[model samples]
Target chain A: MASHFDVAAYALGTLDARGTEAFEGHLASCANCQVELFELQELPGLLDTVAETWPDAPVRGAVIYGLPTKRRRFQHLGAATAAAVLVFLSGAVTAIGFLGWDGADPPAASEPPTALTRLDPVAEEPGGVRGSLESSTSHAWVETTPEGSRIALDLGGITGSTPCSAVVVSRAGETTEIALFDPPKKGERVVVSGTTPYPVAQIDRVEVRRVSSGKIITTLKAPEK
Target chain B: MTERAEWTESRQSAMLPRVGRHTRAVRPVAVVPDDPKDEWVRQLYRQFANQLSAHVLGLTKYDRQWTEDVVQETFIRAWKHADKLDQRPEMLRGWLFVVARRIVIDTHRGRQVRPIEIRGTDIAEDRVGVSDKADSTVDAIVVHDALRRISADQREAIIETYLKGHTVDEAAVLLGIPPGTVKSRTYHAMRALRRALRARG
Candidate 1:
């Protein structure tokens, strides 16, 4: 028999349900196992300390993360990729207008936003759509379905110094406004994933512009399919 | 062979955030890396750093210097891929836990060999460099240092059976000993650790 090492096994999370239940029976009586297991319980916490050091260090997080001190946004990505990303950013941001999260026209959504902690952080980019951006510092990809196209925009460096909004403007001057935010602090990346009701052909440009001054921070023209 | 983790309601609530009363229009979801200058991460570190440090330390088998370096590297990677991490508290904690574990695995894989040396009572403060004021951080360093005091065989037994989350038979197979030996070694290791911890205090 493996003997009364059940406490240790259970502490290590290696016990099956029956074994665990069996150990729980012993654990209820064994003070020695309880105390020893308590010390062993700290094992995982100590392991975490090893990696938690970098954040507590004197150097900046960006420098330690191996990102250059100079803010080279989208420096790792190519120009074509950047434009395509901007196209998606604008498209997705505009989709907020249709989807109903637009900051400007926040449709009757007076209710509190679902707790930020409740959101799934994973970026979901389904395959099968085409899009483009120009003169951009962001990256993007597109997902298309019979319903329409949704653009997944990576807002890595657009933490401008003023309130910002992504506006999708059609050739005929029609516009859908989405994603309004105060200037994000430097080095913060804001990401938006939204779908557009209009096909890629009908959209002329997706511009990330300052809401306060109406100046264009960056703009990407739609690439034709 | 396993610790079953049933998905209770609490653990399963990490679905994406939704808004409004009904589904009138498809919502355009956005995740802005909040507190980009390490504020949010700092808080997260404060919360989970102890548990994560302890687990990673085990993976490295009591290499304090190696553990500290790997933990820092993991968080840096977390920031670089910030958008992927913007989620609920429990999910964020789980995400960091997984990332820290992977870092430990990667760090171990890159090493030529495990040293298994006990530096006596000297905390690897030099390798950790900057002294963290957090009591949990200090305690982790101290406890890890003590693990080194026990014989390597006993320490390895404890790690395989306890920290690595292995069964006794599983640990015995890895350590090339009988299951009985794994237990005795673990029993002695725990006693030694308790003594060392009390002595350090």
Candidate 2:
């Protein structure tokens, strides 16, 4: 004594095996259920059409778990040969490069280059910075150092813009634009050491515009970073 | 060292027979010399590869290469499970869709530390007919539109059971409902979907 709902559900492959069996038992005696099943069969076809928008291809290397038994031995041999060749090449390159080097003295270890230190935001007065600029497109941020001598612009926020590109241009006509395929979300900060083109370190004057649209989303100036 | 060697030897011996059986199963039988199964798999790939790749790209916002990798992985799983699949070739498309979705989920989950949000873009606009293409004889768009009309919970229940291959128990756990409720909701949702698809057709 299944309902019409059960029959339709079974036909649509949404019902479990037990439900499907129950519906089929009802369907065996009821012409209405049979007709409904026929009708419901069309649903999968239609659903397929809606799913068509998202086309996907079958994955590869799924057929074979690993190398075929026959090929395994040959593969091992080939790998050993490759390793030997690589070792020989490395030795030859090292011999050629360091052939004339004196063994008497070891080179002194040079100190690593100093990393740029980030300034503490708490040290600066809260209202000392008058204007603020932010990018509307993504999570782009510009932080002014407490000393007002440098500004760090982290361009990590530009997520889904086509023809994705960004540039950091100073007032002195110095422009450095880098084309990013997948820009990091953690914003990269650029320091504005001094003001040349603009009187103050005004981010409002330093426009961050999309190359394609030419829309300036963020515009503001630091107190004097 | 001796115990370890013995354990390794036993494991290898156990696996050898299973591997042999697998290889033998792929060999052509006397009745079907050409092995229609292999052809069937190839045809499945040719028919669905591009569409599946598009769907994956839509969901992940990944490059075409990554989408291809997903597709490749899905097919590899299919081949490994070919014996189970042979009896259900008619259900192959549904199984592949489920497998592909699982792979996407697993890939995302594996990189849990960096959760990448797939941004919706117009890149997949042209391939919008994929759902329909899964079964072209029927009006898939109508069914889709009708699905939208249903309650979101109902729709999700139906999708989880069928498209996503969740068992009633699993769906119940996921939806935080009783298994009986899941069964009932799935039954009702399927009925609605079938009716809508039929009406459109």
Best by DockQ: 2
**lDDT of model 2 at residue A225?**
30
Tens-place lDDT per residue, model 2, B98-119, is: 4465455445535444324221
Q: Model 2: per-residue lDDT, tens digit, A1-225?
A: 456556544544555545544544454345565555444544554553344332211100110111133124323446655444333323211110100111122222231101101122223222122112222211112223333322223232343335443444555656444222332334432212121222223322344455677654333222223
Task: Give the distance in Å from residue A5's predicted Cα in candidate 1 to where it truly belongs.
Answer: 4.0
- Supply every candidate's count of residue pairs whose N, Cα or C atoms clash at under 3 angstroms: 28, 43
Stretches off by above 4 angstroms in model 1 are: A1-4, A16-18, A47-225, B1-135, B162-165
Candidate 2 local lDDT, residue A51: 44
Model 2: TM-score, first chain: 0.23
Stretch of 10 with least lDDT, candidate 1 chain B: B1-10
Interface Cα root-mean-square deviation for all models: 19.8, 20.0
Per-residue lDDT of A6 in model 1? 57
Q: Supply the global lDDT for candidate 2.
A: 0.42
TM-score of chain A of each: 0.40, 0.23
Model 2 misplaced regions, further than 4 Å: A1-4, A49-225, B1-138, B194-201
Report how far residue A54 has shifted in candidate 1, in Å. 15
The all-Cα superposition gives candidate 2 an RMSD in Å to the true structure of: 23.7
For candidate 2, what is the DockQ? Answer: 0.10
